[model samples]
Target: MEKVRATRYVLPLREGGSMPGLVEADDDGMYVVKFRGAGQGLKVLVAEVVVGLLGRTIGVDVPDLVEIELPPAIARYEADEEVQDLLDASLGSNLGLDFLPGAFGYDGSRVPDAATAQAIVWLDAFTANVDRTWHNPNLLWWHDRLVAIDHGAALYFHHSWPSRAPSPERFAAQRFDASTHVLADVAGTTAVAARHEELAALLTPEVIRGVVEAAPEEWLETTADLPDADAVREAYVACLGARLAAPAAWLPGADR
Candidate 1:
């Protein structure tokens, strides 16, 4: 992943709870940044990188992600107390995505091609991301292409972290309810199931380990069970690998 410095806090996107901001970076690029200091904490940022990268590897349309350095000076001039506090807390590293200029939210009117829809649905099922529902589709229609965003809600198993020992077995068997998925209609369950072999081949252990390692070291919280960032990364890789190995348990309509 590329690293850039955040030059200015362009604006705060209040639509979601995390309050990811539209930031201007030293590279003169506009990015949507998900801060480390957000209420949900660093785990969400980890999920964003892992799931996003995994999606990218599997031919899914995901925005380019980068590690953005947020200097304290930008927070010093902020007028809003809440946003300023967020910036102050998130003083060092943050997650930023290449901003899509005029991307519109996904609705049924502009559904993607059948293959693309199947790929998205399969990816969501594997990651256990329930946020891609009809009510709040995290997909974007940019330049008439389907762009997936906001995977913070995907890896819910990580939130247990220090409190609960990382459970690859549990996550591996966690069933994903995709009946309400945004692309459920367009992506037939049987069709998606047929893609299991090809899609599964794309996510090798080496590939998964790299995605988990993509997260910043500081973002990975140390627990009694997971003493280091590398350990945490290994835990994620294991969980995802186990899930990939056991598709019938979690892959939606796998039995079909």
Candidate 2:
């Protein structure tokens, strides 16, 4: 991903807990910036990039991601104490998704077709994303198509790394309940099952490695268990690979 310097802190999108902000970059593009110093920390950002890349790999529409450099001055100009605090903490590089102009939130009325819905469900299930529901779809209707967003909630297994070593097997065996998924009715188990292999094939080891490596090194938090960024990347690759190899464990409604 290309790196762009944030020229201005436009405004905060306060819908979610993290409170991602809108900002203008040196590239003359506006982006919804996810701060590295948010309450969720860097792990959420990692999930966003990884799952986002996976989504794009299998033909799901996602916003273009970029690394946005946040200079301290941007935070200084913010008047709101809360916004200023967040900006002050997020003083370095952060993640940015290209802002889609005139986009509206998904309201279930504008559902994607069976194929697209299947791909989305498959992607969500594969990544163990639970945020896409009636309440918070995290999806956008842009250019008359459904664009996936807010993957920070996916890949929940990583949050445990501070307590224990990265466990690929556990994540692999994790079952995903799609009953409440936003697209469950539209995609159905059959549609998702049928597209499993096709989508999985697109996430080859090389492809997975590329996605994992795409995450900014600073955001790949290092712990005593995972001492370095490369090790953390490997852990992600292993977890994703294990899950892909054992579809019966997580793929909802797959014949075991």
Candidate 3:
């Protein structure tokens, strides 16, 4: 794992959802840091780190993410001189990173063409991510590439126990049923299937292992102990393969 220079700075983006801090690191450059506030338990943080690793290994264009070690005193320093100066000069609230300096979305007048849209849909289905939609796309335009952010919802509601009986209400554990609009659109678009197959090779056990190995120690202890890299890869491959083979009438699974 490469060493990243961690600089502590309050983020200017304030989205209503996750309260993530932004950090400019020397290794990965810039990253959105999700704070594990008192309200958030270790599980959520684990989810973020694990999902991020898996997403990146599969060739998904995810933003650089890292765990920020904040001091207890820093919490009360929300009114520090530097922090106050940042808030006053910034256009939006610095409460959290809903917005970033150079980050922007696709033009409202021109949604992604069928190909790109379907690509995203296919990836989301494979990951069981329910957050992507017309509303908060979580898709950003970076250097002419579409990037996904704020994936705090994928694989949600999973059973922590190995022998737990699964139920219909078990949203996270369920496989992707093809009937969903996202799934239908994705399959119908030839571009998506072709791209999916091309990228399939990247989603390997070695890839998953690399991501897990690169993750911070605290992150591992939180999310089901990293699921053996091979197991993780196999699970994703099985889910994606099944989704691809399923009839189009099935509904795509939910993320949260």
- For every candidate in turn, the CA RMSD to the true structure comes to 0.9, 0.8, 7.5
Candidate 2 accuracy as lDDT: 0.93
lDDT per model vs. reference: 0.92, 0.93, 0.48
What ranking of all candidate models by lDDT puts the best one first?
A: 2, 1, 3
lDDT of 2 by residue, 33-61 (tens): 99988998999999999999999999999
TM-score against native, each model: 0.98, 0.98, 0.62
* Model 2 misplacement above 4 A: none
Off by over 4 Å in 1: none
TM-score of 3: 0.62
Better of 1 and 2 by lDDT: 2
RMSD (Cα, Å) of candidate 2? 0.8
* lDDT-best of 2 and 3: 2
lDDT measured at residue 102 in model 2 versus the true structure, 0 to 100: 98
| Candidate 2, number of clashes | 0
Candidate 3's residue-wise lDDT over 1-256, tens digit each? 3444434454534663544556554353565655544134344554555566666666566665544444334434465564444323332111122224476874454455555565556656655677665556677776666666665666554335234422223333455543443324434644555566554566565664554455445433223533554444344334434443342322233222
Native-to-model Cα distance after best TM-score fit, residue 216 in candidate 1, in Å: 1.1
